[model samples]
Target: MGLWDDLKMQYRMGGITQRLIFWNIGVFLVSLIFYEFRLGTFIFPDWLALSSDPLVLAIHPWTLLTYAFLHSGFLHLLFNMLVLNYAGMLFLTFFKEKQLVGLYILSAIFSGIIFCGAYFLMGRVSIIVGASAAIMAILVAATTYSPHMPIRLLLIGRVQLWHMTAVILIIDLMQLMIENTGGHISHLAGAFFGFTYIKLLQTGTDLSKIVTGTVDGVLRMFKPSQPKPFKKVHRNYNTQPRSTTASKTAVKDKKQQQIDEILDKISRSGYDSLTQQEKDFLFNAGK
Candidate 1:
């Protein structure tokens, strides 16, 4: 296969996070191509910026959603995509695919709103573009969901996921006070959404449901309908009863039943009530 075809195949087979990164990279490259050829610029213009201009922002409101797919430079795209891949995989472990897509789009839009709000207040008039805000949202979500989850640093030993998230937030806060204040503000918005999303989920209110429905609707349009076929049954003239593997199976079943009872007790009285051996078992099982 050709290089382009291979890339397409890889992208199609990639997970949600990878697919998003591919889309952002593809858009960024297209923008670069246009810029290099001196053709019509693919970058969104300032007039399309979501600022105080109510009419413009209303008519082209889709830009708020699309802007996250556009990136300025290679380094910018690389960092954002890397974070997205890591966080997105973690997010899928607990969330449904539809919820993941919904959260991503919502995070992107909220990030744009914060970006424009900051620009307007700070007297900066420039079009905002990039997936950094959305990526930050995913990062916050993953770290918050698994705060004690260990992650290895290059030179340093392992640290809790929450620590990494805190460092990122601190840096972004400091940056907001210095350069690219609007961008940092956008990061804050994404972080807020991520944090709040987890909180709300704990309380049983999931905002991702709306996005899930929309995605399901779109997918249903392309699905083909198939009729059920009749099944045929044959009678056996001579049948023998199968004997149960009692000896070996009984031992395994007893172990599983004991584990289930322990889990049920923990659910009833909380993990603190679990004995040291039970705690060790749980930890090792998780690993």
Candidate 2:
């Protein structure tokens, strides 16, 4: 399959990360068309974009989550989606697919609530849109889980994930008073969630469990029930065929399992700690 077909298959397979990326992009394109026609950011209805005003939100509470999907401009949308895709992949290195989706949703709502509280405290009203808070949450949460993991960068050769997380978070803190107070407030809130989520997880509490159960419940509701047909219980292990397809699938599954184990090792220690054989496996897999 081509790149497009592969993406379609991924979407159909319901990978949470890819689905979020596609949803953001889809929303961005529609917003862009409306933006051109409506003359400005007003293209997005107030109902879809969150407001710092408590009164406005009281009337349209759903904006807390929906606002995250709308972006102010193309560059804003592009940067957010890029970061989300990168951080999200890194996040999945040690976490389940459901956790990422839950983090994004919970972070957005947390950020919105923080933004509203700040507005109320400061007696200000403003509009807010973007996925920065949720993206920040994913980036920070992944770093917290694998703080020592070394990530290669373009200009900066290699840096620990914790180092990057600290710098970005400090920047967000320092910018809180500069402008866009609500946005900065939201960012901080999301960061707090990310940090605490990891801390709580270390204590044996998985905050995403509730969200995961909800997702499973929804899926079960949609899944068609299988009928129970008559079955013969006679065992005949020697009569089973050794199919090539089944063997190939088993080989593929083994390779994937090996890859996952190597990734988990790298997450616990730095990439440099990887064995030569492990490094070669990653190298070949990348190819």
On lDDT, the leading prediction is 2
Residue by residue across 1-287, what tens digits does model 2's lDDT show?
34564445446443567689899989877776555334444456677889888778999999999989988877778889889888998899899888888889888999999988888888888889999999999999999888999998889889988888898888888988997778888888998898888889899998888777888999999999999989879866665467976897899999999989987876576455766677667666755
Q: Which stretches of candidate 1 lie over 4 Å from their true place?
A: 33-44, 47-55, 219-287
Encode model 1's per-residue lDDT on 24-104: one tens digit a residue.
887777666444322433444533333434455667888788778776566667878888878887787778766677788
Any residue pairs clashing in model 1, and if so which? Answer: none
Measured with C-alpha atoms, the lDDT of residue 95 in candidate 2 is: 91
- Measured with C-alpha atoms, the lDDT of residue 243 in candidate 2 is 98
TM-score of each: 0.70, 0.74
